[model samples]
Target: MTWETGGKSEEPDGAGRRDPAPPPVGGILWSVAGDIRVLLTLPSALTMQVAHPAVGAGVDTYSVFRTDPWGRGERSLRSAQLWVYGGEEAAEEGRRLRRLHRTIQGTDTRGRPYHALMPANYAWVHATGFPVFRHASAYLQRRPYTPAEERQLYAEWLRVGRILGIHDRDMPQTLEEFWPYYRRMLAEELELTAVADELTSVDRPVPPPDRGPLALRLPLRLLWPVLFPPIARFRRFATIGLMPPDAREAIGLPWTDAQERRLRALGRVVRVVVPLLPERLRYLPLARRARARARRPG
Candidate 1:
């Protein structure tokens, strides 16, 4: 019923197995998940995640996304970065998320009860990232990952799910199982949830960044109305455009061919531009630090 590591005894996972640790460093996930390009597709992943009824309800009710969007996003990004690059801290972050979600329970808009920790909901949230990553990679990279690379990426993603406390039973164990499961959820479970709609709405009001020094924050607030329209449009574009086509269709979001062409053009630019940046600029802060540490004499 318990497993031990680092002098700590932890409860067995949903499959009655020992805790599945984070994906190994220098693995597929390390190379993929921590890249700055992931930020471009993150909105799509978040949108897909909340399209599930329970996740949407929990987020609509308990999340501070409306009031503190920047802070909430920063924290989410930080947690994601920590999962890939934090070493021992990655498992602790996983535990922290599980603990944080324990209280996220409520009735969804359909009057059905839901909880964040419900295995299906938890697993679905973790599952969305894989497809989105693969889809977005086509545009963000010179080419999408090859079949073998996708298999490796999916395996690595499964380990990341374990780090988030998802059971092997709750999620499809391999790519063959995963696509069917993903399609079934898209057909039967996913919806245009209220939260999903709002997240993808271009007109949705978002405040200026409030994190930095007051001097800069004040000017940003004054300039935000002028600055936000294009940003909001791009956010909406990326959220809807980056989703797998099946998922977009299932949720009734439209994707025009023109938009697809534009997205590809932008992706082409990103592919050319991103790799030219130095590591400090290319990777997120945590990943950058981790790479620096790995390069040190040891």
Candidate 2:
């Protein structure tokens, strides 16, 4: 959440001049469960300036340093190296690794200093681990990070990036580029729960038909109705402020002067529709059924 960039300098001629900060150099950091992954991007030169001195000095200084995944001790360098190198190929691998790392680490959408936990937990569940079960359990428990711990993790990310030949000037932009991949990974993980529910349902047993016509047709048919109403609603609400300005801006869908008028018109229609629809029917029945079945005892 705390994005830093290079510092600016004062100008002469009475028109205040400023210098833009350098881009982030790639770096590595530790997860809450104490695994090292690259940071890939950082905000300010000052931030990295503060963190640069401690790379590889010892486990205590490194963020990803932990004796074991859940062990309450400093991590060994071997553990950090293992986490960095696992199943990775070496060509521009640091950038790819950092992108994957951020997707799992989750960002502070609200611009907070620390990363969020839920997404990290989701990532840990899917990623193969070194000390496997111990790391997984730490994620499940949602442990909080101490101030020292946060700084340490940040430092480790920077260190790893340096080792991999990632330069400081290229760090921030590199991380931004990698953001999309993280989002895709999170979306894919969410889709898995839906798949699991469908497979386990007794009433909705899998069809024995070969993967042919029925397979192609059923999903399309099922999705068509589900999408139509929402699309209609979104179009109707398009002129209204269906989403907050900041949310739209964060996702790069900033409103224009024309969009403001459209949003207002859409809002008006959505307000009218809300009261007309039954509460139970507001959500799609398919989604509701899935939720209901998920909660049922085995």
Candidate 3:
């Protein structure tokens, strides 16, 4: 009736299976970091939706439910209500979604429809399902929620059920529904990015002279070493099969030209500087040198 790991033990369920350990804080941190990366790289319009207050609130509510479903009590009900009204921002978001939907509805270029561009809008049901189940399991295991939180969580669950066209009586009692939702959400994010890019291109024009200071544009020189390596690795990992042999003749990884130039510049700098430094100072000094080079005027 007990499960043990790293000398820690907890009671097992009646079925005699031990409970899985809680996910490490590191994984949660990494997940947030990945979300940030995706947000930054995505198109402004798509990123705006993810950053919306309502969406953020939903994600927070979802995370809390996943982490401690029973603990949500009254807070869970509040979250559900918030979601129902789409928070204070729903009207604007609804307008944007409608406009985006219209923009993309029949505009598929390669046999894929415009609706494909707003994938995330249609993925709401899937996006909310997994955390609900995951947290429900945790709630059963830990019994940490006040009665109020449990009620609220259930309220939110009921609302989600309605939105997704799930019958309260027929809602999934297990985790089988979670995976499909996650996949659909990811696919929607990809499609949304493509659509956003198209919108940006169509709207491009000269900026006003008094448009004022840029926000979030750190000097690329200062950011290069700190930002480029991980970005390069991520690009490589994400694009393993991005191009077919035939397509490579006409198109390639979007970064092929820029990446080649940066890598060559990096290599040239490394070749000239590495041997000049003392062996003891090489690794540490190399970073400083890279930073310095990044700051230099072209």
RMSD of each: 5.0, 22.8, 20.3
TM-score of 3: 0.27
* lDDT score for residue 234 of model 2: 45
lDDT of each: 0.83, 0.30, 0.32
Candidate number of the best lDDT: 1
Candidate 1 lDDT tens digits, 243-275? 899999988888999999999999989999999
Ranking by lDDT: 1, 3, 2
Task: List TM-scores for all candidates, in order.
Answer: 0.92, 0.22, 0.27
Q: Per-residue lDDT for 1-298 in model 3, tens only?
A: 0000011123221233222221122232112211212222222222223222223333322233233422332232222222233323322322232332232234232343334223343344223432432232221122334546444444444444444333444443333453454444444433223322222232322122222245534455456566655654543422211222121222222335665455445435544664575634542232233334445898
> Candidate 3, residue 289: CA error in Å?
42
Model 2 vs truth, CA RMSD:
22.8
- When summed lDDT is taken over every stretch of 10 residues in candidate 3, the lowest stretch is 1-10
Off by over 4 Å in 3: 1-86, 106-121, 124-221, 231-298
